[model samples]
Target: MTTLYLLGSAAPPVLEIASVIEGAQKRGYDVCLGLTPSAARWLEPQLTDLEQLTGHPVRSEYKAPTGADVWPRADVALFAPATFNSLNSWALGLTSSFVVGFAAEAIGKGIPLVTMPCVNAAYAQHRALDRSIAELRGMGVSVLYGPDGFEPNQPGERRPEGYPWHLALDAVARRTA
Candidate 1:
């Protein structure tokens, strides 16, 4: 089976993550979810449901060093709802969280990574963000943003309903193709 490491960050779109997972599964991918701490907390109420759907636990924190691997190695990974902070941090090689750590290493491991950012226009305009996106793309990370992917909204606007979860799955499918 094609195993996907689906990483979710603390963004409004994290609310629709289940749909993304189901979409990927329907496309013949087995998924393992790795959420940033805040994202995990945001999805707390549905963790059990998510686990049942994926047949594995949703991991936010790192397991004990002695613990065995919880999920199979990823064939591909998608970082959905990739936040401004996570984007910049991952680009800069920051591995403070399990999600970011795995993302950073996935690149070196030759694992295809697709990032679907959910930042607002203001955040997307930050000088660092463009550089980060460029850097990740330069490293072969498929970043879905702008006109062809996700179009950012103005700051303070919440468009959780408008988040393109299907786009993330499509990006992964294209990359894996």
Candidate 2:
């Protein structure tokens, strides 16, 4: 069974991520989730549902029940709807939160890291963000999607219609099969 780490972001995408988690469970993967603080607010109820669906805890902080122990090796680490702040923080090696810490540790261990960033056009077009994204790519992190051909400053405007949970799970399936 593939161990999936569901890293979270903020709202609008929270609903999408819940759908993704449900999809992932239907596909029969062992899913474990971690959410950023902002993402947490939008996903509390959904988190409990995810835990019930996956039969494991949905972690949001390093103090979570599964933290600081030797974790079961994951097949992939996916960050859907990755916020600009979380992306920048991860790109710069900051691990103040559980999601960030897990991503950092996974990267260091050479786990396949995939990110689908959700951000406004102005932030997405910033030079610093560009550099950070480039750096993450250089480190072999695969970015699944981002804003394109969308108006500036509109939150969650450029997200794809369906969540790419299957794509992420397929990647893991191929690797572990």
Candidate 3:
């Protein structure tokens, strides 16, 4: 099966990651779930099930330098609900977290990477956001944002279900096909 590295940040949409994993599986991907540390904690209760669903361990931190990798190499990648922090950090090549680190390296590894951010309008207004988006685009990453992808909600408001998860999957489909 084609392998997909499905990564998420601490955004609310991460609560529904099971459905997204199922969606990727249905599309013929062997999903490997990676999360930011905060997200791992939030989904701790469901980690075992997620690992069972993907047939691999849920990873949030890097392993020892001498250890072998636990999951298979990814053929494609999707980072949905990438918070303002994740998006900028990835673009700037900061590998502090496992997800961001893998994403930064994936760019150089020639992985087909796609990202959809879920920031509220308030955080979206930051100047760094635009630059990050542009930088990732220049690196050949498929960033589904603005009117074409995720539309930011009001700062204090959230509708995690409204995140365009399918858009990211569809982009994955295009690349994998």
Best candidate per lDDT, number?
3
Superposed model 3: Cα runs more than 4 Å off: none
For 46-144, candidate 1 gives per-residue lDDT tens digits of 999999999998999999999989899899999988999999999999999999999999999999999989899999778999999999999999999
Error of 2 at 74 (Å): 1.7
> Cα deviation in Å at residue 111, candidate 1?
0.3
What do the candidate models score in CA lDDT, each in turn?
0.92, 0.71, 0.94
Error of 3 at 9 (Å): 0.4
lDDT of 3 by residue, 102-122 (tens): 999999999999999989999
In model 2, where is the ten-residue run with the lowest total lDDT?
144-153
Cα lDDT over the full model 1:
0.92
- Which residue runs of candidate 2 sit more than 4 Å off their true CA positions? 64-71, 146-153, 156-177
The better candidate by TM-score, 1 or 2, is: 1
TM-scores for every predicted model: 0.96, 0.81, 0.97
Better of 2 and 3 by TM-score: 3
Model 3 TM:
0.97
Error of 3 at 89 (Å): 0.6
Worst 10 residues of 3 by lDDT: 155-164
Question: Candidate 3, overall lDDT?
Answer: 0.94
